[model samples]
Target chain A: MTSAVLKPGLTPSRVLIYAVLILACLMYLVPLVVMLLTSFKTPEDINSGNLLTLPHVFSTLGWVKAWATVRGYFWNSVAITVPAVLISTAVGALNGYVLSMWRFRGSQLFFGLLLFGCFLPFQAVLLPASFTLGKMGLANTTAGLVVVHVVYGLAFTTLFFRNFYVSVPEALVKAARLDGAGFFTIFGRVLLPMSVPTIMVCVIWQFTQIWNDFLFGVVFASGDAQPITVALNNLVNTTTGVKEYNVDMAAAMIAGLPTLLVYVLAGKYFLRGLTAGAVKG
Target chain B: MATLELRNVNKTYGSGLPDTLKDIQLKIAEGEFLILVGPSGCGKSTLMNCIAGLENISGGAILVDDADISQMSPKDRDIAMVFQSYALYPTMTVRQNIEFGLKIRKVPKAQIDQEVERVAKLLQIEHLLARKPGQLSGGQQQRVAMGRALARRPKIYLFDEPLSNLDAKLRVEMRTEMKLMHQRLKTTTVYVTHDQIEAMTLGDKVAVMKDGIIQQFGTPKEIYSEPANLFVASFIGSPPMNFIPVKPAGGRGRWHVPLATDLGQLSLPLAAGDADLDQRELILGLRPEQLALAAEGDSAVLQARVEVTEPTGPDTLIFVTINGTKVCCRLAPDLAPAVGEMLKLSFDAGKALLFDAKTGERLARESKTPAEGSAGNVAQFRGR
Candidate 1:
């Protein structure tokens, strides 16, 4: 039996706290459990039993069909997220380095403008972003989606990196400058090497965000070029074919798995990176 | 080894703001150690930064080797600096920290290794080469910071209070080490510090600054013995210079400053050139060591009751109320006075300085030998 966190004995408040926590956990876990169970069931079994019930017969048919349906779009999501995440993170680091360390006239105001981009709702940029992509001859392409994600992802990534870099002593840059290290050299050696935690935060954040992004994916790309989120939406919402709940559940699970795995593997660093700047002197 | 000259250097944050460094002028010969000493926010560090090319000067020029470097970037200036915080690269090991500068300047791989080894051995950190800054103690980190600056044979080195963070014992140890290092390297160096002892001990030339202006620039002895003004005199002494106000008097023709002692009033005569001091408040500046116990027959003795006694091992400090202000006198430990004992004090008359109380500027004139008749304080007290 797990003991209460604050007191070893089973106090009434401790019991009440654990009760509220367990209920919260179940509220989140229940949907995942339902998805997990339904994904393994045949459509007939899914209809016959409720969300929690075990399948009468476990079948690979749903898994096979979901993979067949979303396989191409998964690769597209990878293409969009991989380049988008890397480019956005690298640009953000440079932006952060300049903003925090090599400040020029109006740099703070520029950063203020850049930060304004972080608060901008994605819906606000849809029309202009589409127009720009169309002008660049990138409409309805994976390249267009990648560009959209990178442009959108930059605000948050820069915010993360800038906040982290601000806590780094300006003396470090001064010392580096006196050591004969120029701007890029200082960033590469003195700063970027010390930026691993923030990098982890940026990569994980951008990866999951871009992978799960359906708005830009749907707006910028079309048909076969749609990301896994768009593909999953299409697969789940179709009314023309008989509603296959099992396949729909499996497809949704498949689309969500990469982000889930990324979180599970690196969740500790993401949280650690966010608080590292705040607690540091 | 290079000579550094700051010619009419002026810096301001913006058009309307007061200058951070105002019309600063200084020159140090090759291999000289120059110290900029002052209190916090005195612009010593800012001047050092301007010298290092980290901060731009709004006017004037900095020359290294007699060439203008004010327009050059820090990298192009060939200057090295050790920050007060050490500023050691946190991610790099000791070796990498030392190697970084050489590698950035594109020195050969073999030369980089050789340079790192040289600095490591010189700083006595050969064993710490593999360890990161986080794993090192404060002193060790400081050594690595020095090692990084020393790795390159730069024209000039700037140290911005590099040892201020260490414990007292270590700070003293480092002060000696810094002087020794300068003697060996003989590079033109500029150092900034608030601690007067470090300024006195380390610099071949000391510049005492306050409020962004260089108040006095001279050798340690000159700065100590002939401080340009009240601030410099007060700032450069350990138990800072005692500044006692000279009591203003009613009879103006004689210009004798009055001091009320336990025995009687002592009148000090001012010269004809000091006639201007008659209308204003006057101050007398004397070092604690300048005050000594009066011999029985001494002429210019201050008679007062001792208020406190502090025996600082090397010397004893006896505090007495003189002219209503607490005054400190340094005497031999064996002659330590008991608290509340009445004591007779006499100061070196020639070295005594007078200042205008309001402006805090030294009132310079030929030495005044305080009238010998004032010594009657001891005789008067004894007779009573």
Candidate 2:
């Protein structure tokens, strides 16, 4: 008798949700499908408006030529992103620990300034940042791009973890203090271990930002140091031959894959980390 | 083992705000269990936090073993606190949480494991070692929290309403376990709780506080029977000590307290040394259990209409009116009286207390000469 109600409870929400979800999923997938089909097509197939069709002759030439000519820029993206995520996450955690636990004069002011960084548009800072990087001898190198990624990433990552660590009961920290743990000890042993979800969120967010960056690479990097975003743009709109849309699509997918895998793997915690201290209490 | 003495300690959040702990003076002997009992926001938790070094004292010295530790960091205080929320590291398993303190102290891994196992077994959380705090029930979580503190073997243990979150049966069981553990360990401990029964049963000495000031500091029995003031008297008892405002109508030689009820005027006997009676405003404090059904002729007997009767299995609480004030009489379950019926109640005047109604100060006078045969075990109830 209870199963009668339980049946609808389980099946109704799932049925309705899955129905709408599948339709939504298809809508999202259509663009990516079109992009992939274009990436595989010859310039003629793309111009002919046969965009969503399979290649008449399946070709790896676009992939081969793109990899040979444009793969360094892809490597440049990896170079910029990996170090950027690592540096920003490490610094952000420290910033969060300080903001959450310690009380000092102007600590709140400093945090307010960092939060303000999140609201500022990249376009507003682009000219000055470019000039600053050039003056600092980091203009077009992977290091310059890394510095930019880390700068922008810091605001979001610090804000993410600052709020995360704030909800960790102050009593636990006090208990640790009475247990003979110092500030760094508590942060390393207690706060850091509990910050897995928040760290994953920061890492995924920063990885996507740095990996999918077009503006920074365009403004900063002039040559071989340009990232895959620059490379993908160049592939689609080069001055030489007609664009290889299939290769462009594939490269875009490849550049986006790291963040996709991150979300797919740690998606549950990512969602949890985003909405912590909401209903969980 | 150490003697903890708070000498004129005062804590204020800010200059303009009232003090949270006002000129608090207490001396707890080595291995003595001192229970700070008070209502919420009465500064019991604040006192505990100050003692644990979690909160800083605004004035005076807090000495442990004759050494001032007011400025010491919480880590240097050798104190372990079991918080009201349990405050177990939610991410860690029971075993890990217990071992955290030992690990911080750089204890050898083997010793940490052994100590963790010992406390886990003592708390009966051995089977829960692998489980996270979220997996455990509230009672189990409370045990693990206690285990974390016990693993440290610190100079003193502080419990801030540790069992308050548990259900009734579990709270009673935990109370018993706590008493037994204190007996076995003999660790100097200070516990803060609002439950008067817990305060009465657990502590060698109890400090009752109200509005940031210690109302009375004495053994549980003392606080119960000879509360320093009207507030303490009223706060300590279960159905609560009934306070009936009375006036000293007659001169000292006559010594009378006038009753102004429908039952007719009755003049109760008063003690000789009630100097505050000159003001004609005094409060009569009668514990519910002290008032009894007048079986036969008894001293200080009065007849009043029973307005309410509550039979609570073991005893019946009978409410009656005396001089326009509601008075409670605790009678045996078999002696339940019908509501609206006139019930004659008697009280031993020796058990009654007089307080200055305006100031809430005790009159501090012996009511009657001790009975010849009944030398009075009542003093035993004073300062247990």
Candidate 3:
């Protein structure tokens, strides 16, 4: 495969293409490398050295400071993101199964309306959402943030799952039905098992969306319930005697790490899911 | 085992649209293999779906063992269907696919395992039990699909063109395998296919459908030799039955159909003495195999210039024009006349059929001497 891609002999054009690809890779990695380097530097090293240089004195002080400030909100993000991802994903699977397989009157229209949610601007709904949450006495709670993320994330998750299930032959459903499987039985025994790729896509998408969300997190949650993104912003914006650039970078990395870890772990499935959803849809 | 029946079954897409299936009536005795054969858009698949209760009938009842199952859900109907696409669950291993139905019925784990093993052994797919469907070849997947159905002893097995996706050679092999499996199980089965050869060979009873209506329903031999209409005659045979236009030839109580050749016109006598045959347009149908090279002393002989010849290995097909209608005659390869050669062809009038040209309906009603001693024909048409 590599020989097929590279061809037998390399021409100047091939060399040029390789040069451009390497340059593009370095361009993308520069910021990440700078962030890592900055997170390892002591405040004195950061002050003395250029941003790209290795720390003159490597230290754990930045990480310790960042963790002290961000740990509670990191747990809050976990508390909010996990249940939100699970509920939305489950709801998406059910919606996808019904819309694709067991369709009834107005199902297409119902799905159309659900898909319309994907385009609704969060800014436009944020005020009304906050008002409703306050009326329901769920404002400023992790549970409220969970509800917010799940509701907002459902459209995308359903789109992923519906497109995936649509590619599955309807004959499988009919065969299962004849095999004495009812709705849930067919979903559990047939549809769900075939859905690992799409589920991975949805969870990754929703996890990243909910975990990285600052607007909803800052607006709907506060103090003890604030997610890492909101907490990081507050920590970085605090007016103080001296700015802790290393701590801010460390804090930002901490805020970003779960999604990065998720992608790193399941990145192959993430890509497969996207392309599979595209082809099927 | 079950006796399956469709009574006045009708299916229409909606109130304004035409019916997709119209007044389909059929019966299959216990362990009988019924073949529903038709071209695309002929509702053969729809009838199979209706019988499986996957599609609801707009008008009538479906019965199994004399009990109406039209209202029952597909699962409650005790029917298993093998689809054209196989529909094997891609996520399941072969064993799990075969065991799925039993598991759904909440059968004990041990029994399910035993049934899966039995089916795997029966289908010769025991080695494939650990592999997912995507890992297997098409033929292997087909076997696993059959195993899934065979794992459960449903009242009936419905095969909707199950062999359609296989290559021609594998289809023939699987066709025989299907017959052998059915013989061992003795399950009532309904198979749908567009292939006339499968219809003829696999069916104990064959239903030839056209435009959502059954054109003919009879034993395979009966359908072959004594078709009910021009459509049935044309649809059921390979290289199809030839239709020659004929008009009354004389005023006497005799009728002759005209045949054309480049040399001259020849005439053949029609055995039917019905008065309605006079001064009326008619069509005479004869199967290609029924027309042969004329030998010395053959009674009904006509000379024609061969237009084309196709050698199909087992037999050569000779094409000639009769009354301006192209006629195909199947004959032994050695005796096949070359194109443009003058040839004498003889057709037995006893095996010939007549139909009303306008209505396309069969005109003559006479007892045809059964050429082959096929069991279904003997039992179903003995009195006729």
Kindly give the number of clashing pairs for every candidate: 1, 6, 0
- Candidate 1's displacement at residue A107, Å, is 2.0
Candidate 3: C-alpha RMSD after superposition: 3.2
Q: Which order, best to worst by TM-score?
A: 3, 1, 2
Across all candidates, the chain A TM-score values are: 0.95, 0.87, 0.95
Alpha carbon deviation, residue A94, candidate 1 (Å): 1.3
lDDT of 3 by residue, A72-129 (tens): 9999999999999999999999989989998899999999999999999999889999
Q: lDDT per prediction?
A: 0.85, 0.83, 0.88
lDDT of 1 by residue, B1-384 (tens): 899988999999998888898888888889999999999998999999999988999999998888999999999999999999999999988898898888889999999988888888888999999999999999999999999989998999999999999999999998899888888889889999999999999998899888888887777877787666788889998898898898555453456667776666566555425345546778888899999998988787767888899999999998887788888889999987898888778767667777778777666554432222222111000000
Give me the candidate number with maximum TM-score: 3
Can you tell me the CAPRI class of model 1? high
Clash pairs, candidate 2, are A38-A245, A38-A246, A39-A245, A39-A246, A40-A246, B222-B383
Which run of 10 residues does model 3 chain B get worst, by summed lDDT?
A: B375-384
Worst 10 residues of 2 chain B by lDDT: B375-384
Runs in model 2 deviating more than 4 A are A1-25, A41-49, B272-276, B366-384
Quote each prediction's TM-score.
0.92, 0.92, 0.94
* TM-score: the better of candidates 2 and 3: 3
Best by lDDT: 3
Query: lDDT per residue, candidate 2, A1-281, as tens digits?
Result: 88886666657778899899999999999988886776677666667776677877666666677677667877888889999999999899999999988757899999999999899898999999999898999988889989998998999999988988888778888888888889898889888988898888888888888888889899999878898888778766777865566667777766667778877988888887888846555
> Model 1, which residues run further than 4 Å from truth?
A1-7, A10-16, B247-256, B269-280, B365-384
Kindly list the per-residue Cα lDDT of model 3 for residues B89-185, writing each as its tens digit: 8889888888889988999999998898888888899999999998999999999989888889899999999999999999999999999988888
Q: Return the clash pairs for model 3, or none.
A: none
